[model samples]
Every structure is written in C-alpha cells, then in structure tokens.
Target chain A: MSDFVQSLRLWFAPGRIKDEGETPDYRFSLANERTFLAWIRTALALVGGGFAVDQFLPDLRWGVRVGLALALLAAGVLCALRAVNHWVRCERAMRRGEDLPVSRFPAVLSLAVAVVALAMVVVVVFGWAGR
Target chain B: MTEVRDPGLQPERTRLAWRRTTLSCTVVAVLAVKVAVHDDITAAGLTGLALSALVWVAFLAVAHRRIRALDAARPHPLSYRGALLAAVCTIALAVCGAAMIW
Candidate 1:
C-alpha cells in the first residue's frame, strides 16, 4: 500500500517525469498538448452551460432545473479530470516510444451529452405544452 | 540534412489552442460572475466569485507560459505539473459554478 501511495505521489509530483523517457518528436507532444487543451475547453463549456440553465431558466421546474444543471456540472468535472490524466499518460507513452494510450471516453462523453440534450428537449416541449 | 523547423506549423496551432482555451475559460469565469451577482451578494457568493477569479488567473498564467514556450524551434514538452495545474484549476472553477447554482 505504501508503495502504491508513493508511486501515486511521484506520478503527481512536478518535474519527475521529465527524466524518465527519451524525448519524442516535438510535434507529437504539441499535438497532445492541444488535445488536452481542447478537453479543458469542452469541460469549461459544459460548466458554463450548467450555470446558464440554472440562471436563465427561472420558470423551469425546480427538480428538473437542478437535475439538468447538476448533470452538466458533473460531466464537466469528470472531463476535466480525464483531460489531465490522459495528457500525462500520452506524454509518458511518447517518451517511452510506446503506442499512444486509447480509451472509450470520447464515446462515453458523447453519450452523456446526448442524454442531457434529450432531457432538455423533453422538459422544454412538455413544459411548453403544459403552460 | 538540415531538417526544417516547424514544418507543419504545429507550434503555432498549439499556441492558438492555448489562446482559444484561455478565452473559453474567461467566458466561464464571466458566466460565474454573472451568476454570483444575479442574486443579492452574500459573503459566500463573494468568496466563491473571488476563488473562481483566482483559479482563472492561475490557468491563464499556465496557458500563457506554454504559449510562449511553443515559440521555440523545438518547443519543450509540457511539464507534468503544468498540465495537472491547468486541469485542477478548470475543475475548481466548475465546482465554483456548481456551488453558485446551489
């Protein structure tokens, strides 16, 4: 347990990864950096969307309003965490001449966003009809 | 063979990505501020807004440093710490946004 904790701390500590692997092509690193930034931006947009729903939709049913806002905010938080961890993983892979890490996060994130959009549509359509 | 520097403008593209992300972060901060002030300003609201502003500035500084670093002939890889810091600030800002809503 101590070993795992130490490794986790070292993984997160600043400047430790620089010495581990040979420097790969700068272009690949830059690309990875850009991808990380893109994910961060996506997270920010989701958070902003959450705040917008809560602030702009005063007439929204309280339960639905909080639900949608919390969903979006939660997604944003997960994306933000995923963004950094993936960035570190890719950078490490490139340094070690290994294959870039891959995962199903993009698909999962898409599904999450779609579900939120669908929920919004249902709430809007039904709420309008009820009014 | 004298390899060309920046053969595909990758550094420029990366720099622009940083800029765009920074702008989006700024937008989020603005939105948070609006929400914070939308209702009567309480001490907690003010504190949340202040923390969000601080996080935005920290992220901005990190992005700006990386942007400048990309101008080199071969931009150094982003440090692990820098990337983590950027991500943490972003998450903190999102938490602030959530708190404002509640």
Candidate 2:
C-alpha cells in the first residue's frame, strides 16, 4: 500500500545517501560500521570468558576469583572505549579528506594481555606442582 | 558541503573484535561467580553481580556513544584519554584473568 511504502521510506530513509552526481565515500562508512560491529562482538566475548573461568575453577580462592572478575570487567570497558575512539577518528578522516589516524592501543594491549596470561600460567603450574 | 574522506574501513573490523573480547570477559565473570558460590555462595553471588553490573554499564555507554558518533555528520576520532583508559582496563583484566588461572 502507499502508506506502507511511505513508512518504509521514512524508517530506512538514507540520510547520507550519496548522489550519482557525487563521488560517494562508500569505503569510509563501510569501514566505520564494520569496526562498530567488531567492538560489540569483542565485548560479548570478554563476558563469555569471565563466565568460563568462574565455572571451571570452582576451587579457586578469592585471589583468583576476584582477579578474573576484574580482568573481564577491564576488557569490556576497554573494548567499548576502543569502538568509540575508532568511530571518532574515522569520522574526522572523512571530514578532512585525510587518512585515518593509526591506533597503537592494540599492540600495547596485546603485550599486556600476554604478560598477564604468562603470569597466570606460572602460578597455575607452580600451584599444581606443590599439590 | 565539503566532501569528507572516509577513513579506511578499519573501524568495522575493530568493533567486531571488541565484541568477542567482551563476550569472553562475561563468561569468565560468570564462572568466577560459580566458584565463589562453592566457597561462600553469598559472597560469590554478590561479587558476580557487581562485576556484571559494572561491565554492562560500561558496554552500554560505549555502544551508545558509538551510535551517536555515526549519526553525526562529522565524527570525532577516538580521544587519547579514552584510549589510555582502555589500555589500563585491558592490562588490569589480563592480570585478573591470570590470577584466576594460577
């Protein structure tokens, strides 16, 4: 019906549609959306990780239990922050017609994660050894 | 209106990665609670609830901000402060995860 068509147009109305006469910056928008979705997925994964630790390590003491909780919480917060940061940089690039800013957070965070994980491995191994 | 150059489609990929990370964190938190319950179920329950609440709030806030940025005609790049905060959080979480395993 005409009403349905009108409603659809209103709901899905392309606010920033590129005109044929205009050079569309499709790549930028596409990239931005993709990044947004990626962050969301990461956040979900972190939460899942927390649950996994809690369930499997029932014998863990306060130190382990609390540590796991904190780590997951940190991951969730970090992921969310990164997503926002990515969006801002991408948008700025679009506006200025320049390259997007590079991110160093990933590398730094990765290193931190690796180190912590390593420590955990050590602790678990030693604890088991004693047992 | 001036034509803006869209940054490379990197944000999308980054976003997806973050989502996975968060999901994993959530799982860990739940498991931590389960263990807590056995030792002191009430305390464990409280800790789990607290952690969940904190994470959920943080996630929701970030998601909301990202959506708003997308809608805006001119999106701002992620701030250095925001990035720093994220980095610190990540390191903290990694440490915590390690502690649990150890």
Q: Give the DockQ (C-alpha) for candidate 1.
A: 0.80
Full-model lDDT for every candidate? 0.85, 0.52
Instruction: Candidate 1: list runs displaced more than 4 Å.
Output: A1-10, A14-16, B1-5
TM-score, B chain, candidate 2?
A: 0.51
True contacts kept of 2: 0.23
Clashing pairs in 1: none
lDDT of 2 at B100: 38
Candidate 1 structure quality by residue, lDDT tens digits, A1-131: 67335446656574665777888888888899999999999999999999899889998988899889988989999998889878877877787787887889999999999999999999999989999
lDDT of 2 by residue, B32-96 (tens): 44543545546545654565456445654554465455443345444333333443444344444
Residue A120 C-alpha lDDT in model 2: 67
